[model samples]
Structures are given as C-alpha cells and as structure tokens.
Target: MKTVILIGAQGHMGQAAMTGLKKHNVITASRSGTGCDHTVDITSKASIKALFEKVGPFDAVVNTVGYCEYANFSEMTDEQWDTTIQSKMVGQINLVNVGLNYINNGGSFTLISGILNVKPIPMAIADATTSGAIDTFVQCVAHELPRQIRINVVNPTVLEEAWDVYGEMMPGFQPVPGALVGKAFERSVDGFITGKVIFVDA
Candidate 1:
C-alpha cells in the first residue's frame, strides 16, 4: 500500500478525498479534528517539516489548503492578498520543498488550484492570481525535483457546496461536486500526470 499524506484533510474537498482514498495508507494533516493524525499550518515551514518528520517517508503528498477572499482588486487589502498568497501559492511551494526530502522515487505531489484563473468572475482577483501562480510553479518546478518526483495542480470550478453563496451570481455555470474533484486528485497522484493542471468542471 502506498502511503499518502493529505494537508487540509478536514475541509469539504479534503473529506471527500479522504473517503475516496480509504484504500490507501492515508494520513491526515490539518489544524483541527481527531480525524486528522497530523497538525500543520501550511504558511509555516517549521510546522510542515514537523509533520513530515512524524509521518516519515510517503508515496505522495496532497495539499488542499488555501484561503480565498472574494473582492474587487481595488478593494482588496494587502492583508487579504498576503493571506491567500501565503496559504495557496507560497505555501504550496513550501510543501514541495519539504515533501521532496521524504518522498520515495516516482512519488508525486498534488496541489489545488481553481478554475478562476481561466474563467474569472467578479470579486475573485486574489484567488485568480494565486491560482495562476501555482500552475506556473508546477510547470516550471517539475524539471527541478529529484527522484523523478512529479508535481501537478488540480483546478476545480465552484463546488456544489458554494451554491447558497455564489450560485445565483454565476448564471448557467455548473457547479462541480467536491467528490468529483477528489477523483482528479486520484488521477494526479496515481496516473502519469506531471507539470499539468487538470481542470475539474464536470
């Protein structure tokens, strides 16, 4: 059985991934819940390092943590930008740096992006910018890692869970299920996908 460490393993998508990956030797890392075996703050490399220490080596590491704010670029605060960027972009880079040290050869690293980078909507400036940055990083960094380790990003559209808040605003746009996105994660890790951003809209 391949060992997999999942960050942000308590959120909606994370929970769905956990359910989908039940057959694997899965370990959960996050801020809360007894459901998660490890605790991590993605913005802090020290915390991430500590978790890897406890988990030891693994076949794959999946990061699904990132905070996003919906606001116009002119209205976005420096704090909001920093929070999302650190949580999504820089934090994912940190995961690669840390995970590379412990992953076995042919292991994979999967990070989450969102479709806003390609299909932008109003009030998504912070999210779109970070999403684009992550995809670029994956494409470039795939050649830099050792042991044939691969890196990929999954860009998902709005989830069905967001309907109450964001559905009406997006006329005719379909909301994909978080469970379906879990399958994208499976493909990125188990399939031969590297330096690519898999879009999860259907």
Candidate 2:
C-alpha cells in the first residue's frame, strides 16, 4: 500500500477520506497536532517543508482542510480577505510548491475545493473565489509537474455529515455523502487521471 499523508485528519471530511483510503498507510496531520502524526500550518511554507522533512518519504498527499471567512462583499474587511487567501488559496498551493522536493515520484496530490465556485451563496464570495483558483491551479500545474506526479481537486458540495452545521447556509443545495466524496480522493490517488476536478454533489 502507498504511504499517504492526510492533512486535516481530525475534521469530518478528513475522517470521511480515511474510509476510502483504508487500504493505504495513512499519516495524519492537523494544525494543532492533536491526535495527528505531525503538525502543519499550510499558510507557512516552512511548516509544510518541515512536515515533509519529518515524515521522511511518502507516496501521496491529500489535503482536506482550508479556512474561509463568510461576509457580504460590502462588509468584508481586508483582514478577512487576507485570511481567506492565505489559508485557502496560497496555503494549499504552497503544499504543492514545497512538497515537490520530498514526495516520491509517481505519487499524487489530492486537494479540496468546494462547490461554491460553481453554485455560489451569499456572503461566500471569498470562499468561492479561492475554490475556483484552486481548481484552475490544479489544471495548470498538472502539465508542468515532473516524474509523473499527478494532481486533482475534489469539489464537493456541503457534506451530509456537515449539513447540521452548514445546512442553513446552503439553502436549496443538496448535501452529498462524505463516503462518496472520499471516493473521489480515492480516484485521484489510485487512478491515472490528473488535473481533473472531481465533483461530489448529490
């Protein structure tokens, strides 16, 4: 089985992904390092670099977390925008930027992006924009990556498990099972396709 590093391992989505990746050797990570194999702050390149260095070697990487702020466009503060960009956009990108040095050849990267970019909701401009950016980034980077390294983004709608918390915000949108979303990550990690956005909406 491939050795895979799964970020945000404590979150609901991360737990969901773990189900599908059960066959692999999964290394867990989170910002707090609580119950995780290592700690990482995706916003900092140094932190990401250090995690990879500490882990030694891995065959795949799956990122299941990013923070985004919700606010009306008119009321959105500069700090809010900066936080979203740093954590959701630049932070995830940095994983790929820094991970290249340590990841095993032919290994894959699976990133998380939400469905907000395509079906947006009020007060989610920043979140939607970052999700779109990540999708586009993955598509563009797929062509440039060396050593057969592949990349894909999973664009899932609100998860059924998270619906109790996020349901109100989604309104008419349907929530998908976390298991289905996890399978999308499985596809990216185990399949040959790259630069694809696997949507998990039900």
**Whose TM-score is greatest here?**
2
TM-score for candidate 1, please give it.
0.93
Clashes of each: 0, 0
Give the whole-model CA lDDT for all candidates, comma-separated: 0.86, 0.94
For residues 1-202, write the lDDT of model 1, one tens digit per residue: 7799988887876875665576789999887645788899888989888988999879999888888877889999999998998888899899999888888999999998888899888888899999999999999998898888999998888778767777876677799887888888888888887999888985
Residue pairs of candidate 1 with colliding backbone atoms = none
RMSD of model 2 against the true structure: 0.6
lDDT of 2 by residue, 129-177 (tens): 9999999999999999999999999999998899999999889999988
Clashing pairs in 2: none
Q: After superposition, how far is residue 34 of candidate 2 from its true place, in Å?
A: 1.2
Full-model lDDT, candidate 2: 0.94
lDDT of 2 at 67: 97
TM-score of each: 0.93, 0.99
